[model samples]
Target: MDKYTKIIEQIKALEADMVDFKIVDFYGRLRHVTIPTTNITDKKLQFGFGFDGSNFGFAETGKSDFVARPVIKDFVELDPCLEDPTATFMCDVYEAAQDVKPYESDPRGILRKACNYMQSLGVADMATWGPELEFYLFNDLLVRTDPQAMSAEIISDEGYWGSQDDDYSFATRLPKKGGYHSVPPNDTQYQTRVEAVRRLTSLGYDVKYHHHEVGGPGQCEVEFNLMDSMVAADCIILGKYIIRNTAQEFGSYASFLPKPIFGEAGNGLHVHFLMKGKNGELVFHDPNGYMGLSKMALSFLAGILTHAPAITAITNPSTNSYKRLVRGYEAPCNCCYGMANRNAAVRIPAYATQPEEKRFEYRVGDATFNPYLALASILMAGLDGVKKSLDPEGKFGPLEKMDKGWEPPVSIPASLKEALEALQKDHQFLLDGGVFTKGMLEKFISDKMQDHLRIERTPHPVEFEMYELI
Candidate 1:
């Protein structure tokens, strides 16, 4: 039997009542359609279901016609919720004609193009990624912005400051920066983490583990097992869905916002990547070399460091993102690489002992980014470096040694405006593989600039307390 038939039979055997086919848009939002189990057929899988892309910021209303082609290989069973038993599938967006795959505008298509382009260059058959998912769980959240009033508030039962509240008698409060791996009483989300792991594993994700992150107030992380770049990106979207749904089930909300609370640590999605050749040899590995890094690895690092500020415009796209990029927090403010340095933008982890494990982590990205596009852009930049043998010009510290005299490179862009300006100037590398087209770049810039303006025009709550008197 064909794969789709096997999937349908599996669904039938599982007695699944509903099937959800979802597409991740350019902005990384999950848009899906739910259908009864009776409709799970091979014809539906081949022809694909149609949807309007305009709602997803794709195009004008008139040109919004699109179809979602199910990727059966990416199918998984849904979490056990009280509502209905369901199966889920990731889909590719295509034009109504279905002959031509949608271009750069489609997030999935962009990822496919990136993979194919990498193959075309005869560089690597696949790219692998491991993203440390970071997020905050809160009991209550509220926000309002209008002509007469504007304010935002978030309350966490697990917050260090909220421990004294009457509702938190059972809670074990963590001190500031004390949340990392705290056991039972202090890690209030233990049950939630277990549920998240079970759900993610049920959905075919090999979860590493979930734990309380460095930030107090319910900050947590669920690390998935590594996968190829494209599949990893898809997993990221699905992982977020599982997190949100699981949180909702427990009467809580999960947010990936980088800086959900001020005066505390922030959430960051640090991605570790590996590039391997067709012979199954890691191109980045050299045992005798610096940090066991080959020349190609150094060039790849150079590409990323050179294009990091521009990459940040996409990787850390949100205005609140910059709030976490300050110096003292281990955020990657400096555009440099070092062996086992948490302070560097690109960190070569000391954990890798084998050729496959020898990978570097890019610390700039947060949970706000579209993983497919963000990863693809980084790959393209690295490919550009490979093509040009781009020497890292600015400042790269001692690869083998570090001393007080070795100053780190200049810092990454300090603000969204600066990051955007960097992107505007340095985005040619993103177009190397046609993974990110000019039209898409233009739209992204326009959308982000509007977001920047919206935040810029708004008055801060602190402003009323500080500037009103002045």
Candidate 2:
């Protein structure tokens, strides 16, 4: 009769032995709980199973109890990854109190609230996002972090390293930065990517295309069609899951690390977004506007550029993220926008000529981001820009005109600490509509600061190579 009852009935039809409940943790990793299907009832589906929130880094030990309530809409009767017939559902975390409430820091919940907030305003009833998920597929990956030995070895059958070994080498080993859209033989991960995309298609995703990326070491990309904000974020989370699982099945490893290989194009989760007005009109397109972007679109672009450093504190929170953001890798190093300019933080895609297709891409993010937080932060900042009518024309760019000696007003933060510090000073926008609370921001900053310090104190393998002679 009810949605949960309907979901239970559907699961029963599948005759699944177990129900797999999956949730995204603070760091964007998937955490799961399994229960026999016999125990699944409507009440269980409604109330959800309990878990320790502190273990997810969401609360202290004293206040760690939380509920992982499954979303009825996310129920999947057949999962392609699992060999067994197990029903799977994605979950949203909530407080396990007498008066149950949505967890404020829950990444998914935060994005949901942001979407609702956007709709509450008269400007837009819905926001759609198209995200490009890029990652590396490795044939072999090894890492040692011991005090006596610290090193990482990444072996890609399609890379030049494969050429050194006659036994393992393929005839078409890819040279550094040479794998973009490469065909078979050179693109050794082709079947793996195709299989991953097939699984995604089975899971109801509209994949645009997938191909080898510029990093000849097996870097690949999978682009998905535009969907609602929350759905887009969920797609990224589960997309990575299916990809990683599928890679393992093929005896390979899929890594979303921003800069897994030095001197190569890095992985980026470039997002393109456009809002729909109350009348269902595209809010970002204008034929008379600069490069066919409406005033509201420019304002949105300004918001992202203005708050990019702060947003990067969440989107590119890892230390290795900076390694990819540096110059010469096409990663944005400046807070600016340009028509089809890959070097700017935001770029209006050259091919998006139609009203529905017109949208600006945020180029400064990576797969290391928690999709929910990363996307929500960008939306909040853009909404704030809309509220203020922030114009980026003179301040940020149409950088193509820089042949006359133009200088950027802002530079992207060069380190994680700098980005976090920017977040500390410029986070009032994130607090709009109660999407993000001060406490949540504080926790995120403190936790990331600890991570940065830990990495700083550790000795890197490159350190030995550089300082051993001294």
After superposition on all C-alphas, the RMSD of every candidate to the true structure, in Å, is 2.3, 1.5
- Local distance difference test, each candidate: 0.81, 0.89
1-470 in candidate 2: lDDT tens per residue?
88888888888888888999999998888899999989999899988989998889889999899999988784554677998888988899999899998998999999999999988877688988888999999987898989889878887778777633455656667878998999988888899999999988887888999999998889899998888888899899999999999999999999999998888889999988888887779888899998888999899889889998899998898998999999898899999889999999999888988887888889999888899999999999999999999998988888886655676777889999999999999999999889999999999999999989989999888887899999
For candidate 1, lDDT tens digit of each residue in 1-470?
88778888888877788888888887888878888988677889876888888888888798888888877763446645436778777788888754746645788788778889989998788888888899988876788888778876777776766533454434576777878888877787788878878877766677888889888788899987678887789778878887888888888888999998888788899988888898777888888866788778778888888788888998988999999999777788888787788888898888887776888899999989999888888888888878777665346664446566566565688888888888999888778767788888888888888888998998878888998988
Cα misplacement distance, residue 403 of candidate 1 (Å): 5.5
Which stretches in model 2 have alpha-carbon errors above 4 Å? 163-169
In order of appearance, the predictions have TM-scores of: 0.94, 0.97
Q: What's the number of clashes in each of the models? A: 0, 0
Q: Best candidate, TM-score-wise?
A: 2
Residue pairs in clash, model 2: none
Off by over 4 Å in 1: 74-76, 79-82, 98-100, 163-171, 392-394, 399-410
